[model samples]
Target: MTPAFPDPHPTTSTIAEVAICEVGPRDGLQVEDQIIATEDKITFIERLANAGLDTVEATSFVSPKWVPQLADSAEVFAGVRHLKRVHLPVLVPNERGLDRALAAGVESIAVFVSATESFARNNLNTGWQEALAAAERVTSVAQTSGLHVRGYVSMCFGDPWEGRVPIDDVLSVARRLFAAGCSEVSLGDTIGVASAGHVRELLGRFTAEERTRLALHAHDTYGQALANVLAGLDSGIRIFDSAAGGLGGCPFAGSATGNLATEDLVWMLEGMGIRTGVELPSLVEASSWMADLLGRASPSSVVRALSA
Candidate 1:
């Protein structure tokens, strides 16, 4: 039998509450071979909202030349009406991306910078210092425009070019992002090479208060996403980024899958009696719909088993 859905109002405490930022539409759809209808994208977001996810990374405002998948971002934004309580954040890689997102009336935006110099040079085509400078400029403009900006630190676990990222390097980048006015810095395992032990060792450098300002953005390429998440939770990190149906991959990193599936994360959290406030069955249903629309299989085992 399928596991019972989590209670709507459970009076529980020991289990920590985590903010699951669903990146299904933006990260998930961008890597697909087929283009989902604009109305379908809106339907996906609506279903996510109905599943009790308060913060959803709705879309990216990149140029159509780069990612034609999210070229319909403006139209999708106009169509998907979110609850006042829900936060619909979009990815804005630079000033131009921010401009488009602003025009679309996006309330929040995410800016990213790589931790290692090689990754920065290869992925962003800019040096580490230049990328930081660029992010500073974008963050300033976003703040002035009354948009809440979040920063992402890619290759926090390990760089494909350079191996074993130092703890000081990760902390320095995160501190810089925090100082640059980004509210939260999401540490990304861009290649999905992190182990639970590695997570504990790396996160040990930050204190409880410092950890609160961090978010975990992990890939499931090596199938260690859940274990890393549990380690992050132990370290006091409460926010995580996940894609629905596991529909994402780093165009820059070969063999890297998308961030962990939101469905799988919800299933694990609910099973552990952790309160995410996300309705798993409804959320999984949305993932199933999106997977069917894309004509591809889902990357989430929980979605497959539950839907079966």
Candidate 2:
């Protein structure tokens, strides 16, 4: 179905092809205090695949001791690997993480590095350079094994520890990821401090060619995620990362809220007459089901309003 959102206005502006990467199972479950059952994870993944998601982050390959919530990564992947036309990407932080993912027969991997030195150390226990190197090595190994790699630059907008992240810092991290052979680099507003103006300003710096390799990962902490997304869309950004039922927060950053919900994103896109290739009702149904499983109210306004 064609989206109601008008096509981009022709004023020397071009809209980049947009793609939504679903991170419900991995990012969403990681922050939940309750451990989601393996079967439930598989079910959630399958529902998302059925809802027409092209890419879904199935789980993280971090050590079970570190992230007990996703300890069933292999089980979830093993259960849902048969789903057709859906790509399951796993998060791998290091060699061990990559090895775990490889053992699970994962063909796509995501590695992340923080834009700020402090955030890098806080999240990965390494500084920016070290974290970048680690991510590069992880991508290298995965590429050698014929796996697709996605790079993540977290805390791209602002940092809790550091006041304002410079544009140069963001670009440097992004360039490193791209040069390291990542298919794309997802820019994360980890703290949710970014505004629409910031989104436009940051995105405006990259050329059309450079922008083609970018994705916006916004959060709704300050209730500005939708605005930020619009700014990104206007700037020709097409790829976004959202969580189902608005599940997920940085465990390391207490001030951050959950991610922008998939239901809300689809609602806005469909309302604007833009096609997301996602079934809104089915996704909303799946969101409701997952929220019930998590035993928490969803942060997605569309889910709440529609379900009501």
Candidate 3:
């Protein structure tokens, strides 16, 4: 499927390629009521790779007590680790999670910290300061071991409990993460409340050098994820995080909805003549397969429209 709009900004030719990180197997399935079998999860990752996604978030190496759906992270990693040229990144919340991920032979890992104190406490059971400290520690260790680390700053725009997050607070966490040796820091609109203006304003705060090491992870709760992505694109961001079939929501965040769907993002990008290295038809097929596994229609409009 193609986008409905014409090239509104034809002269804006700064970015050549956009890298998408697919987070369906981890963030998407974490909140699912049914636990996906480890073998099936491996198949999903392979299918995503087959659809031209070079980077896929395989699973989270957190406690089973917290996310029972991804309890077989080790098996999932082992199963998909042999896929040539596909970078599989797993989420590591703490030192223990990092240890588990490292043992599973993961080449890349991501650590998360909330920009607001309320979400920090609610999600990680720690203050924002403590969360940063933990992220710093994990990032340091992971980088020293020759592993690539991606840092996430959640609630960068607005938090459910804490209304508007300050720009300074978000930058502080991002700077600390980069200082701690994270190759890139992904800014997350966790509750999907950010508008294009908010996105441009926030990206405006970062220097051009800092923008190179940044990525956008926008949720679509308010139907603003794609708009926010365009804002980021105008601001020089080349990387974005998305879930297949729009299959993610925060289990801890009550108001959180699905992450931006990869299929929809690719459609918009392709329509803009932007190169995403993803095949839209194959991606929609993968989303449909996942929707069947979850026993529900995909939340992605592109998937529904193309399938129809």
Candidate 4:
């Protein structure tokens, strides 16, 4: 059974509510050298749902040649399709990925494009325009198939090759994604180079209405992910993406690090009296279990502190 979580947008709340999308099963594990078994991935996702994460990125449907770790996307989706109340969104890079996700009965899918030309070529082997066009095609097909589509604009802060990305470039990709029928666009700090000021500036470009359609995906390479997240929250962003046990980095991006830890985010949010509906202890337990399975201590401070 899917664990119950509060409404993502509460109709009445004194404190602002935030929605966390757990990307452990997909983004968190994609770059890991040790491939976790398919059944273990399914179990980890189930644990996340039970801990009250409303959205869980289950797996990606990319080619095995590209991401051999997630080659079992279909099997993972099949195993967890029975879970209710939680949105299981899988990443689909192109039409072929979308087809695989659809055949596996995926209800929601995420498409990715980079903000910088160099990273775009490195990750997708194409320029920004070509990647955007592909995203448009995939988004259209996914929407027509009755799947909720989320778009990811990577390197929104700074690219490894391109030092600082222009805000206009980031907005351009986001605009196209939104125009192409994506319900939400996640701005990703793929290299974890963004500071609080950078986050505020990027969000400042969006109108209040447009801001509602945005999500923040931060990495903790410089230990600034939480601070950047606070900046995003101050700018009225209520949705953020995080990984369990701080377990992911972009394989293609050198110097990249794990994503902002879900447990750490929850710890901070709950302390501020912001309701995320996640049981912190349960989340720590989940991450701790995952860390043990992966043969390491969790990278999240909250998980380590609590376990100690």
All predictions: root-mean-square deviation over Cα?
2.5, 3.7, 2.8, 4.1
- TM-score, cand. 3 vs. native: 0.95
- Output the lDDT of residue 177, model 1: 91
Give model 2's TM-score versus the native structure: 0.94
Q: Global CA lDDT of candidate 3, please?
A: 0.91
Q: List the global CA lDDT of all models.
A: 0.86, 0.88, 0.91, 0.91
Clash pairs of candidate 1? 248-258
lDDT string for model 1 (233-258, tens) is 88888999998888788877776787
Scored by lDDT, model 2 comes in at 0.88
Which stretches of candidate 4 lie above 4 Å from their native place?
Answer: 1-14
Over 4 Å off in model 2, which ranges? 1-17
Residue 95 in candidate 1 has what lDDT?
90
* Candidate 2 minimal-lDDT segment of 10 residues: 1-10
Candidate 3 residue-pair clash tally:
0
Error of 3 at 265 (Å): 0.2
| Local accuracy of candidate 4 as per-residue lDDT tens digits, 52-144 | 999999999999999999999999999999998899999999899988888999999999999999998999989989999999999998888
- TM-score per candidate, in order? 0.93, 0.94, 0.95, 0.95
What is candidate 4's local distance difference test score? 0.91
Clashing pairs in 4: none
